[model samples]
Target: MKVFTQFTDEEVRKAQVSVLELLLINHPLDCPVCDRGGECPLQDQALAFGPGASRYEEAKRTYRKPLPLSPLVNLDRERCVLCARCTRFCDQISGDRFIELFDRGGAEQVGISAGQDFRSPFSGNTVQICPVGALTATTYRFAARPFDVATGDTICPHCGDNLDVNDAWACDKGRFAFSFVDQPTRLTTPLLRDHGLEPASFDETLAAVATWCRGGRAAVLAGGRLSNEDAYALSKLARTGLRTNDIDARPFPCDPSALPAERAQATGGMAVTYRDVELAKLIVVVGLDAEQEVPILHLRIRKAARQGARIVVIHPRRTRSYDVAEHV
Candidate 1:
C-alpha cells in the first residue's frame, strides 16, 4: 500500500479558515475605529478565508488598549496574536533589540525592553509590518481611513527612491508630512483667469488652454515630480498637439545645450545604485549629505559601512554622515 498527501484549493482554504477562526476568537470587530481599516491583513484574511460566523461566542479578551510601547509606537495588546514579526524584525534587521516577546505561551506578549524606548530610526517599520492593527503609529492613529485617502506611487522627493509616500511602509516624514496636501487654503479646482481667477471645469480649462496654445509657440516645462509616463505624454503633446519641439523636465536648466555631458550624466540613468553602495569596498561621498538629504540612503550607507565598506566624505563642513565616514 502507498499513501501520499495531497491538498486541493478548497481543502487549503478550509484549513486557513480554521486557523483564522481561532486567531479571530479574541479579536475586536472595531474595523471602523481602526486606523488600518480597509488595508488590514486580519480583516482581509477573515473576509477571504474564514468562518462566516464565529463559533467562539464567549466575551472577547480585553486590555487597556493601546499600551504605550514608545513615544512613536503604540501597542494594542488585545489585537495582538503574539506573532513575533515586529520583534524578529527589530532583533534581526534593525538591530535595535528593543521589541521582544515577553512571557511564554498563553501569556506571551510583544513589548519593548524594560526601561528602553522604541527609539530606533526604523521603528516605523514595526507599525507597518504588524499583521493586525496591534501596532500603530501614534501620529497617524485615527487620522484617515485607507479608503478615504488616495495613494500614488511616487518617488521620495528627499532621496529619489521609488517609494509611495502615503504607504504603510513609508518613513515617518513620507507618511505624516502629507497633511499639507489637504490644506484648506490649497487649490482644489482648476482656476481660469478671464477678468479674475475663477474655478472652471476640466473640460472648460482644457478648451481655454487649447485656445491659448493655438497659433502660438508653446513649450512644455514639466517638473521632475511628474511620472515618466506623464513626461512622455507631455513630450508627445509638445510635438503632436502643440506643434513645438521645446520640452524640458529638469527644473534648473538655464541652457539645455550648455551642459551636454552633464545633462547626459544626469539623465543617462543611475551610475551607482543602492546595491553598488552596499557591495562597494570604497564609497566616496561628494557634495551629497545622505543623512539629512535621504535617511534611507544614510541607513544603507551605514549598513554598508558596518559590512566593512570604507566611507570617505569630501565636504568643507562636517555632515551627519561624517559619523559613519572614515574621513571627512
Candidate 2:
C-alpha cells in the first residue's frame, strides 16, 4: 500500500515527462499572447517537467480562433487539453450544461451545441479555473498579463462573511461586471444643473441641496448601494428631519408594508440559510426567480433537490430551476 508522488525515482521522472509530452502533443504554442500566459498551470508544469524540446513536427490541429461561447467567455479549441475542468464545473457545481466535450478522440474539444450560448450566471468561473488559455474572459481578453496586474484583498460587496452562503463562488456580475468603475462616463463628482450639467464643488452642491431642502419637501430616495448604517441614517433623516413618510431604498416602486415582515423574518434571528435549504423537507419559492436573481442560492436549491427535498416555485413564468423544482 505504498504510494510515491515525488519524482526522486528515475522511472517516476520519466513517466511525468511522458505525460507532459502527450498533453502537449497538439497544444498550441501561443502562450506569448495568451491571457493566462504568466499564471498558467500548464506553462509552469511544462517548464518544470516537460521535455526540453518536442519531437513532433507535423501540422497542429486548429480551430476557428477565439470562438465566442458567450458574451463573457471565449474558447480556443486548439489550446484546450481536455482537462474537463470547465465542463465539470458546469455539470457538478452550476448545473448549467451549456458546454460539453464534443466529438471524440483527437478531434474532441469543448463546445456548445449549434445556435446555443453559454448563458449561465456562473459562466465566468470557467475562465478562472481553466488550466490553460483555452477559455478566456471577453472583458479581459488581452487586457493585461498576470505579471502586469496588481491585486489587493477587498471584501466582496455581494455577500459578506458567510462561508456556507456562496461556498467560495461568485456570480458573473460580481466577478466580471467591474468595468463600469473605470468607464469614461462614470461620475466622479456631483453635477449641478446650472446651465445643463456642470461639475460643482462638494460644498457648493451641498449648500444648494440644503437650500432646496429648506425651501420645500424632500423625500429620501436612497440607492441600493448604501450600507446598513447609511440606510438607517437616511431613514432617520427622512422621518425626523424631513418629517415625511415617502422614503424608499428600493430601485422599483413597491408597497412600504410589503417587505417589513419579510425583512423582520430575515433579520430578526430567524434567517433561511443555504444549510437550511439543503436540509429542508419542502421549499416554497414565491415570485422569485432564484437562478436569474441569486445564482448561488439557485445552486443550493438544486443541491437540496438532489438530496430529496421537494422544491415548489410559484413564479409568473418558468425559470431555469424548472428542471429541479416543481412549477406552480
Candidate 3:
C-alpha cells in the first residue's frame, strides 16, 4: 500500500473533515459535560476543519460510561475512536500493557484487560494524548473546564536532588498538584496560633514567628519540591532574617560529609542532557528508575536505543527502560 506523506492545505482540510466525520459518527456531542471539552484536539479540529453538518442520521452507539481503568484513570469507550494511541503508548513508551483494544472493527474500543488496572507511572500521558475525551483523570474529572482555569509555568519539585533546572519535566505529582490551587480548603493567607489558629496579617504573622524563633532554636527544613526562587528566599530568610545557620533544603536525609561531592556533581562543568543521552555511544543508568523517576529521560534514552545506541542499566529491580536497553 502506498502512503502519501505530503498534501496541500486544502487536501489536509478535506481529510480532517472526513476524519472528524467518521470520529463523530458514534461520538457523543456532549462537549459541555466532557472533562476535555474546552482543550480537546477534536474540538479544535472540528472548529477549524470539520464539517458543519453530519450526514449520518443513524442513532449513536452507547456503552457503560467511564469504566474505571485505574483509581486515577478512567475510560469513556464511547468517546474513543479506536486510535490505539493509548494502547500503543502503554506497549511502546511506558512498557505497561494494561489497556488494549478488546473488540474488533466498529465494536473495537480501548479497555483494560480483565483483572488489570491502568497502573502505569506514565498513565496520565495517555489521558493527555487522547485526542477526544476517551481517557480522563479521575481526580480531575469535571473539576473545571480548560477556559475556567489559569496556567503558569513552574519547575518540578518531585526530584529535587537533581540541580540542573533546564532539563526538568513535570512528573505525576507536579502535573496534578496544581489542582490544589483551586481547592476551597487550601490556605490563602497566613494564620497565627496563640490560643487558637486565626487568620492574621502578613506582618503580624512574620513578627510573631520571628519572636518565637528568636526565643528558641529553630530550623527551616524545606522540601525538594520548592522552586529555585522559593528555596533561595527561604535560605535568605533563614540566614539573614532569622539569623540561624540551621537550614537545609534536602528533603531526605543525606550524609553531611558527602554534601560537597554531591554539590559538585549537581553543578559540575560537565552535565548529561537529553541531547547527550541521544548522541552517547554508551549510556549507563544506575540506581535511577527512569520510568518512575524521570519518564522524559526514559523517552530520550529509548529514542537513542532505537537509533542503535547501546544502553546499560545497573539496578536491583528491572525498569521499563530495561526493555529497550542492551543489558540490565
Model 3 stretches with alpha carbons more than 4 Å out: 1-18, 47-52, 160-169, 177-267
Each candidate: how many clashes? 0, 0, 1
Model 3 clash pairs are 157-225
Candidate 1's error at 200, in angstroms? 34
Residue pairs of candidate 2 with colliding backbone atoms: none
Give me the overall lDDT of model 1.
0.75
In terms of lDDT, the best-performing candidate is 2
Arranged by lDDT with the best first, the candidates are 2, 3, 1
For each candidate, the alpha-carbon lDDT, in order, equals 0.75, 0.81, 0.77
Q: After superposition, how far is residue 69 of candidate 2 from its true place, in Å?
A: 1.8
For 152-208, candidate 1 gives per-residue lDDT tens digits of: 666554335526455323455554556677789998889999799999999999998
lDDT of 3: 0.77
Q: Model 1: how large is the Cα RMSD against the reference?
A: 9.0
- C-alpha RMSD (angstroms) for model 3: 5.8
Q: Which segments of model 2 are wrong by more than 4 Å?
A: 6-8, 158-167, 186-216, 250-273
Q: How close is candidate 3 to the true structure, as a TM-score?
A: 0.68
Q: How high is each candidate's TM-score?
A: 0.58, 0.82, 0.68
